[model samples]
Target: MSPNLAWRPIRFTPQLERTYVQCMTPRIILLQRLACIIGIASFVGYQFWDLLLDPEALPRTAPIRLAIIAMFAVVLVITFVPSLRTPRYLMIQYIVVYTLLGIGWSLILAKLPNGFLAGVSGFLLGMIFIPVLVNGAMQAAVILTPLVLGPLLVMTLAGATRLEIVNAFSWIVGGAGFAVGFAYLLDVINRHAFQLEQLLEAEKTRSEKLLLNVLPAEIAERLKAGEEPLADHCGSVTVLFADLVGFTELSRKLRANDLVNLLNDLFSRFDNLVEQHRAEKIKTIGDAYMAAAGLSGNKRDHVAAIADLALDMRMAFVEFCQDHHLELKLRIGVHSGEVVAGVIGRQKFAYDLWGDTVNVASRMESGGLPDEIQISAETKELLPARYRVVPRGEIEIKGHLQRMTYFLQGGV
Candidate 1:
């Protein structure tokens, strides 16, 4: 997962090493079982060779073969031990047991009649099969070199001809070289696949985060689940709209980048407040921010949450203005009613609301006084008695007759 754990020629980070071991452990266990079964069968079957080639050698080798079979049985049983089943521990066990098995085979070969020829053939097969049992080139070499040279050394001490030694050396080294090359290729391919998988996982995480930022969590999941025309009739929701007072004139005076920076700073604070109060920020239009509560789950206190969010937004905007040395005001409007909320657009998707409640909330912001939070009668009725409100009665709302409104002052 981290760059530091990327594959290297000789050494690997602990994370990569653990991952490799985890991936290979089951395969290794299977191969170990197969090896044990084959080794037992061949050792039992080879008693005929002892009878035909050298009757004198039978008594000497029979017990040794039985002992080796017992050892193979022990190794096979170790694989099933629950305590030793971790990846690293199992790998270590495999290496140790396999190396010992190679040694045992070498000793058995040395005991047979015309043992030099038999040892040469046996060691050649081992060198060829080493890569499949082990993972990396270095690991293959570790098992291979000792098995190859150890038997040759034993044969030399047993007074083998120089020609026999030379022939065995040539064949064993050639096979080991080929096996090591194949092991290296396998390592490279495995590492590439691992890196690709990590990249894909990271990309999926980023896409999900971006989607969550664009839409509410519930809506995003619905879209992901192939729910088309995603819409809901919210019977009770409190919507809040806040617009920066005189931002149009301020934008005219400031540079484009400065204007954007100012809006970003101010709205970023509003975003934090929305999160703190458990409200879903619908979207921002220029200097105006829209958010709603009770759009997702059962939040019976949605009105109170939106009211607290609006008050916090007013305070946060005041602090932002002081920090930036500007005289600015925020006009926030609150209204509670039914609305149709859904995801709109196929390309640049938007989660928005459509209903008379949304229109009335917007009109509350547009028609309200600067530096104040305005609320429709529906919202005012839901507020706790702790909050202070004064009637702004009979305001002329756009596309509607005069309606009762109130200015939300502050908590008593």
Candidate 2:
């Protein structure tokens, strides 16, 4: 059977995994300490009663007291020792040392004249609480098995009364069954909660990714922060607009899917070039692609970056048409000036530029020839010294007056 087709494994993310190890584990160690303290306190209080009534039993009680103390000291070290506090060590300590301690105490109690109560209580205490300290159901069961059975066997062999034997056996079986069942229930709940947390976290990440793809990172953050009327004045920026020439004619001839595929293929390449030059792709409207530079706050190189982007996009458009056996052309126009750029409208957020600069950039594209980079004079001045541009004497733009334009010839 293939791995993908096999049962899916439960995987916890780093945060959920850490919650179990770093956060939950320490608290469990504290629970173990509490359990030990309560057992010791109860036993000591009972023994004190005996001490006040009859001081003669101290000789036999001394060894049992010392054994309890020794067991506690060992557990204390395992609980707090930096190296031994790990889940694995805690489980091992419970299974091996704790079980031995239980057996040793039971042996001492059975040897005593009247010690059946103490021995049975100790066995039940360890069986019931060991599961609360360790994490897994299996580990809890492993620890409870020896801790419960070892003491009962010792009491039976040490000449415990028949009534005492029956009582010890009942407590052992009942406590073991309860501990195992309760631990498994808690384990199931923990796993279910971990899985739920992972799913919610994964969905949050996927939503954030989709938001970033739609808006610029900064804008997306602002929106998430509950900022409204998002707007910014980009003091000086460069905008490039490219319209696919012959798209109208090709749309009439090509099938619907074929036309969409062609457009998607060409625009995908253009998008890469825009990203390569650190430009913000404003939006793609129909067959027109708009992008800007300097909006990222570092305005010093926007002009040169947009120029490079326009050139690369021109080459990409040509190569895409050739690869797919189609005749297509890109008319790109670039302009540099101040403009207001921001996410506009609440229903559907669209990051766009406004002002004469945007309009002039659009005009440059409309007036541009096929397979040419038409640039306004503002952008032409900012071109690097190595770039070659040919001036196109003043042209009459629709709404704007006469403007000096140039064709951005190939660069060095």
Candidate 3:
């Protein structure tokens, strides 16, 4: 099987793109520093070797020494100067000055006795390992040209024998081939590493966004940090359930896509209201939307917050129905009590609430009339004096005994 066939490509989001760009500058700078150190140190080492080998040759090679110093100055500017530190700028400096330095070294060798034994081929091989400095194939080829041919050109001009010239030419060809091949391999490896980093970042961002959608921010973070079997007891939390009236019959009249779109539009409006009131939306089942306040912390004003959310939802539905020329009504029910909330299931897990509080809240919505907000007696007690709630008398609820319910009228 093809490797690409099994690999699922991740989409690089805008945030990940910015992260990649931010990462690139520092990585390039690090490689440039490494290259500068290696290049400079090698030149110094070669100069010392030449001195130890042929001390008399130094006076004759004064021009060559000056050329090496000039190359050193160029490298310093490319390394320490901020403007000339980029790959493009450094590439230009290396191509021009380093090439000339290679020619000067060749001239120095041609002037000395037993010049071939100094091993100038080793210098040509060092050109392959400059990391980020030699970024492209063309740049590598340019740097190799002088280092490869300069020796033979100088030997020819200095009247070397045919056998000596032929032997040096063979060494030059071998060194140049190895340098070019190594440069290409390094280029491939560096590019592959960069791409792998980008893909990993993209995957991380996608996972975080998916987790946040399923759980609250605080809970998602805890789960990411390896918290398991997540569960919590929330006391004095308010649970609100809002269901769309007449949606079942409406669905029968419209196509599947149209019905889905309508539900998405209505639920999306309710979602905005939940956000505005700082209430966490639990999940939507069919046409019903569930939310809770104080379950995810911030319990001081949970009752008032849920109350505000219900009112906003009522207004949003009114406006939405008016704009769409539809006659949809919203029935919202709220109750305040103790409940156990937690994340469950190892695969496709969901954050959900349990206990009598959740059960009674659902009953309040199912038992209530259309176009109104209903509240259990427990929720009514939590409201402030400024808000108005009228008793609906004792109403028998399914799966439970008779309990007092109230209608939540408009607040002052």
Number of the predicted model whose lDDT against the real structure is largest: 1
Residue-level lDDT tens digits of model 2 in 57-111 = 6666667766776677668666778888877777777777667767776766655
Looking at candidate 1, the ten consecutive residues that score lowest on lDDT are 3-12
* Candidate 2 Cα deviation (angstroms), residue 379: 2.2
Instruction: Determine the C-alpha RMSD for candidate 1 after optimal superposition of all C-alphas.
Output: 4.6
The sequence of per-residue lDDT tens digits that candidate 3 reaches over residues 145-255 is 876677678778888778767777777777667766666665555555667876798899999988987898989998888898899989889999999888888889999
Clashing pairs in 1: none
TM-scores of all predicted structures: 0.80, 0.80, 0.76
What is the C-alpha RMSD, rounded to one decimal, of candidate 2?
5.0
Write down the RMSD of all candidates, one decimal each. 4.6, 5.0, 5.0
**lDDT (10s digit) by residue, model 1, range 189-242:** 666766667679889999999999898888999999999899999999999999
Q: After superposing candidate 2, which stretches have Cα over 4 Å from the reference?
A: 1-90, 104-114, 122-136
lDDT of each: 0.81, 0.79, 0.78
Candidate 3: which pairs clash? none
